[model samples]
Target: MNTNYHYMRFLVSPKTADALSLRQAIQNALVQTFGIVGGSIYLDILWVAEDGNEMVLRTTKEDSTKIVAAVTSASTPRISLQKESSFLPALGSTSVTLDEEDL
Candidate 1:
């Protein structure tokens, strides 16, 4: 079965240089905004800049809104929502970047 996903691009403040830091920031945001349960949501990091304020990620269609809320409402490691795509099917794709808009 094909899984539907929402691709999101976020601009992280205080810039992160690595994926681990970025992931932590997002997780913190989730937990802070929605408590421990929110932290359980899986965030798939699709691509990240080697060192910058940008990164692209994916989440299940059902959790897309929750992710947005966490990003917009979180007080720690402040993040700005940049762009998001309508739910797209994740087929046999190898990778995708924020630069490409094919999805």
Candidate 2:
């Protein structure tokens, strides 16, 4: 199969507590949003910000929309998908600064 991978830039809630928890929350959210198979196949974290408030995710191009929907729909420690890019550098270049209110 020809897989077209894309990167999703996202801002995570600062109240997420810790990196491990945030990661778990993301995975749980993915599973909750897309179900077992789709979430397992599509949701993968490529990079995480130093502060753990931002991240770059990799997913199939076809599943990009669903990934975004999943992240945005998450309730606790809200995750928001900022943009999608085919290039990794492009995803990395755009910096998102978060404030207390933004989280």
lDDT tens digits, residue span 1-103, model 1:
4557678887777777678877887788778878897568977887776676777888877887888888788765667877777543332233646655664
Range of the 10 consecutive residues with the lowest summed lDDT in candidate 2: 14-23
lDDT of 2 by residue, 54-101 (tens): 777787788788767776788877888777787767765756899999
The Cα error of candidate 2 at residue 95, in Å, is 8.3
- Give the candidate number with the greatest lDDT: 2
Candidate 1 regions exceeding 4 Å error are 1-3, 87-103
Candidate 2: C-alpha lDDT: 0.74
Which stretches in model 2 have alpha-carbon errors above 4 Å? 1-3, 15-20, 95-103
Q: Model 1 TM-score?
A: 0.72
Can you give the lDDT of residue 18 in candidate 2? Answer: 59
